[model samples]
Target: MTEPQHILVLGGGEDQLPAYHEARRLGYRVIGVDRRPDALGAAASDLFLCMTTRAPDRIAAMVGHLDVAAVISPASDAAQESVAELSRLLGTPYQPAPDAVRASVDKGWFHTVLDRLGLPGYAYAQSSDEAELRRAAADLPLPVIVKPSDSSGSKGVQVVADPAALPGALAEARRHSFTGEVIVEEMLLGRHLSAEAFLRGSTLATIAVTERSTTGAPHMITTAHTVPAELTPSTEIRLRSMIMDICGELGHTDGPVNFDFVVDAADEIRFIEMGARLGGNGMPLLVRHAFGINTYEAALRLALGQPTELTPRHHRKTALRILTADTDGVLLGVDGTDAVRALPETVELQLFAEPGSRVHRYTQAGHKLGYLLLVADTHDALRAAQARAESLLRFRIEPATPRAASAAAPRSEELTEQIR
Candidate 1:
């Protein structure tokens, strides 16, 4: 009898859970590692290693100790490098070159490479100084976007409509960035869509396109995502072609890839960014529900150099709506969760915070209180279920206590001088 393959899943964010589940479902002995001892995915793995994913030696040692057949990371920038480094140490064929992964991690380099390839997309400039930022703001069109070159989940991203706000936006960008470099780009107006793909060597397989709904103002965090992007067949075909070409250029042979884009009023597709991992917010689960394809399984299979099954078994509508708190304070309570869970289309309701947990003001996706997954036969049904879920949701938070203002005390020297 042959021994079962062992797979190592790095980190345990909401996005990494599906990979762990699918690997186990496929009969692979899975191990999950994270810096946090209480990470969610740790509960589901065969072995849980609480350690730093950035430590390549530790990871390599763990992989060897467990005899892991493959190392996989989902929706993590740091883990991507860790996987590459571990693969190099283990003599595995599963990872892209470190330089190629670096190009994807650094937004400035990604844009430069795409531009050099004459890819169809918006123009972008990287600024590390105030003068350069001001110049870029002057040259770029109004309603431009400023964000950190290496950040994800929409952090440090601001849409500036006026030149006067550029300085403050630049400061905010620098505040969230470790590299001290920000990217300024021309804002393209269009319907946002995400296409997920799996690659094997030079061959590419398109999974499904999802329509994304994001917060419009102060934040660009994704609020909802619906599968089977509401696009005509021709547009979907074009978007898939673009994704395949981009992945090929990036040398992404195996594993999951998500490409985000905007469909302009002219029906043209503009590339935004691509992550070399699974989509977050239960997107992988939603895709499985809609298409009868398991992206998580495909990714593990590819990483193990095994054959993958890429056929879609069904066509349905599925959506994930993130529950966000409207205010910042200690979470007093969450109401109507049981009622929401009773809905027919409600697949899962997950809350990240406890009653006494301190919940900050919702700014980015990271601040979301929880998420609701819904599946239905049609887009209207899915939207209706999401609405019902929202109606049943309630968050009670205490108002934040304001800091006391310091009282100004008169100085004795100033008073004596005035008297003199």
Candidate 2:
């Protein structure tokens, strides 16, 4: 029998499970590496290595001798960096340069590239010191948005409407940053749209523009995302053009690329952040459920140097809304999960916290405890399903003291078990 080829998948978290399973579907043995022993993706893989994907050198020590075919990370920055490093060592088809990934992770770099491309410009500053960050916020136009320079999943993001709020906001942003650096920029106001783009060596195969909602000011936590975002034909064409230009400039030679952009009231499109991998919060599942296509499988096929198809068989709609904790408390019970799951339009309903888990305020995407994922055949049907979700999903909380709050430990806000 021929030896089964091995594919190294970094980040053994729930969001990365699809990549592991997809690689297997393509006849490759999946090897996973993550910092946690109980990572959800590990169960889906043929072998699991308990190691941090952030340290590529360490991961290389374990899989260095393995005859790996390729490396891929679905929803993590650290893991993507490791994939680049491992790909270079293995001589496999992967983004071997850290700079390719930095085009998305480093906001300062992203802005510089945007200026080079003659796109919309936002004045920004970067620094690690809280004093410098506050000064940058003050120096930039008032109502600046401050966020970690190299973090994802809307983690450590804060919009300061007043100068007085800049200091605290800077602290929160710093908490989620691995490099202890933050980007302070002038706020871009308007509808934020999530860009779902799949590419293979600079070839844009498929793209989806989704309408996104977020909690305004203080902390910019995403509230909901709806696929098939209604846009004028001209606007959609322009969006696609811009996304193609971005992927080319970013040197996306292969695999999946995800981005979050905003269309200001002026109808100008500006991408704020991006990732060189599949997105979190069940975005791949949304694409599959909404369009009868699996981007996860597409990404795997690209990694293995196989021909892939991304044509949408049908137009389907997807809507995902997050339910967050208003205050610090213990989760008592989530009522009507069964009823919501029973709904014909309900694609997935996940409650992250158990009956007694301590839940914290929703400052970032990781702080969200549950989400209602729905899919419908039509826009009206999507709205109806959304309404049913809103009414049927209720969170019962064991309220905590007004002054008391759950102490948050430092964690990678991306690819956590709380994610899909």
Candidate 3:
């Protein structure tokens, strides 16, 4: 009897569970990796390794003896470079090179690439030193955005509308950065949008743009995303073309690429960042629901060096409502979940927090409590369903006192169980 070929999966979180399930369904042995032992996806895999996916060489060295055929880091930006490196080491056919992955993750490097390609130029500066960051921010216009150079899920992001808040924002950004580096950019004001697309040979096979809603101001965390974003035909076409051009220039014209962009007041596409991997926050689910295609399976096939099709069978309006808290507290309970789930348009509902789990203010994507997925026959229907669901779902939290808050800070493992 022949041994089953091992497929290395870099993350074993809830968001990464689909990839693991897909790999197993495709008759491949899954080797899941994560730093936490209690990862939800770990139980789903044939084998699980308690280790960080961020270190490529280390992972390769540890798992080299296994019959690993292909490697993938689904729904994670932090582990992408490792996926590329492991692919190279294992002789897999992952399209992105290590340098390209690094460029995609490193905001500073990607901004430079945009400038070199003569794309839309947004004034930005980056540095690890406080003095240098301050000096750079001084040159840019006020009301800038400050964030870690290489972090995701909107972690440590701050909008500095006031000059007095710049220092505090910088400190917050630096605190989240693994390298202590931060990027400050002049705020691009307009409709915040995101796209999920798959590329095959410099051409996009499938794409979907979403209208993004965020918690306003200081910490702009995503709250909801509605697919088939309300846009004129010309605007949609231009945005698609712009994304294609940017992907081609970045040398990420081969697999799944998720993008964050803004359609500014001048109707210009302000490209924010791109990830050479599947997007988190139920992006694949949204794509699947709206486009009648499975990007997760497409991404899996890409990792396996197999051809995958992305032709949409049908189109439908879909919306995702991210569940969040209004204030920092321990989750006492969530009411009306049954009522919300009973709605006709409610397709899926997930609750990440238990009664006693600590939940925080909606400051970043990582702070999400849960999400509601809805589908409808028309735009109006979708909007109505979204509103109805929001009103139906109520979160009861016991607000933490100042001293208790510091002492009872939620551990990463706990949050990983609840949020990620």
Candidate 4:
């Protein structure tokens, strides 16, 4: 009797559960990796490895003996390179170019590729030295964004509207930079949108344009995403064209790719960034619920060098709202969750924080306590359902002590001086 092929999946978080579930459904023996032993996907995996997914060499060395047929890192930017590396070492057909994977995560290199392709891009400067960063920020106009060249989920990202605040922002960016590099660019003012697509050669087989909402300025964490983003037919065409151009130029013309861009009042699109894998924050799940096509399964099939079916089974209105707390405190309870789940429009309700755990204000995507997915027959109904869900769901947090608050306040103010 023939044995089932082994499929290695990086990340075992809530967002990565779909890949693990789909892989199991496809009859592959799943091996899951994550630093957290209690990761949500661990229960779903056939074999779970407790380790960071960022180090490809360590993982490759550890699992090299297995007859791994394919490897995938769903919804994780940090694990894309590792996935590519393992695929190459294991001679899996899903090997994406290592350079392309690096470019997908590096802010400066991504913009450089866009410029080389004559694609729409913003004026940006990158450097590792603090003096150089200040000079770069000076050249740009007021209200610029400073961020680490290699970090995602808005970590160490800051908007500096004043010259006096440049140093502090630079320090934060540098602190988060895995490569100690920072990019300073003008803050493009416009409607933020995210595009999720699967590419076959140069063609976008399945695509979704989503209206992205973020907590405005400074920390700028994503708050919500509404699928089938309202766009003019012409604008949507241009956006699709741009996606092909960017992915094609980077030599990443296959598998899943998601992009972040801003469409200005003049209807001009400025590229922010792109990830060469399934998007994090339950994007694949949302897409599945809204379009009736599962990109997670498609990605797995693609990894195994098999043909995929990405045609939309149905088109429906859907949205995802990130759940977060309002202040730093101990989680006491979550109220009305049962009522919210009973709503007809509620597709899924996931809570990440348990009672007695620590929760913080929503400063970045990482700070989110959970997310709510909703779907309805019409856009208006979807919006109404979302409003209703928000009203019914509540996070109860016990306020932090005065001493603890005092101790945490100086961490930001003192970081600049210490980093200097």
* Model 3 regions lying over 4 Å from their true place: 402-420
Task: Give every collision pair in model 2.
Answer: 201-253
Ranked by lDDT, the better of candidates 2 and 3 is: 3
Candidate 2 segments exceeding 4 Å error:
96-98, 129-131, 327-332, 351-358, 399-420
Per-residue CA lDDT of candidate 4, range 1-420, in tens?
676678999998877888888888998899899998878878888888899998878888887777788899877787887888788778997888665697777989999888988877777899898898888788899899999998888889988998999899899889888889999998999999998899987699989889998888887778889998999999999988888878777788788988889999989988898899998877887788889998999999999999888999888889988888777778768878899899999988888878988878777677788878998888899889988888787776655757645774444322111000
Residue 29 in candidate 2, Cα distance off native in Å: 3.1
User: How much lDDT does candidate 1 score?
Assistant: 0.76
Q: Which stretches of candidate 1 lie over 4 Å from their true place?
A: 1-6, 25-31, 42-51, 61-64, 97-100, 399-420
Question: Judged by lDDT, which candidate is best?
Answer: 4
Q: Model 2, range 87-126, lDDT digits (tens) per residue?
A: 8777786444465688756887888888888988888998
Candidate 4 is scored at a TM of 0.92
How much is 330 displaced in model 4, in angstroms?
Answer: 2.5
For model 4, the local distance difference test gives 0.84
Which candidate, 2 or 4, has the higher TM-score?
4
Q: What would the TM-scores of all predictions be? A: 0.87, 0.89, 0.92, 0.92
Ranking by lDDT: 4, 3, 2, 1
What tens-digit string does per-residue lDDT give for candidate 1 at 1-420? 776677888888777887888888878888888988878877888888888777878877766855678888877765777788887787665766554577656888877666766777676888788788788778877989988887777888898997888888888988877678888888888898777766666666657788888887555778888887888889877776766667667776666777778898888988777778776666677777777888888878878878888788978788877777765667767878899899999877888888887776667777777777788988899888887777677776654544311325434322111000
Residue 255 error, candidate 4, Å: 0.5
On a 0 to 1 TM-score scale, where does candidate 3 land against the true structure? 0.92
How much does candidate 2 score in TM-score? 0.89
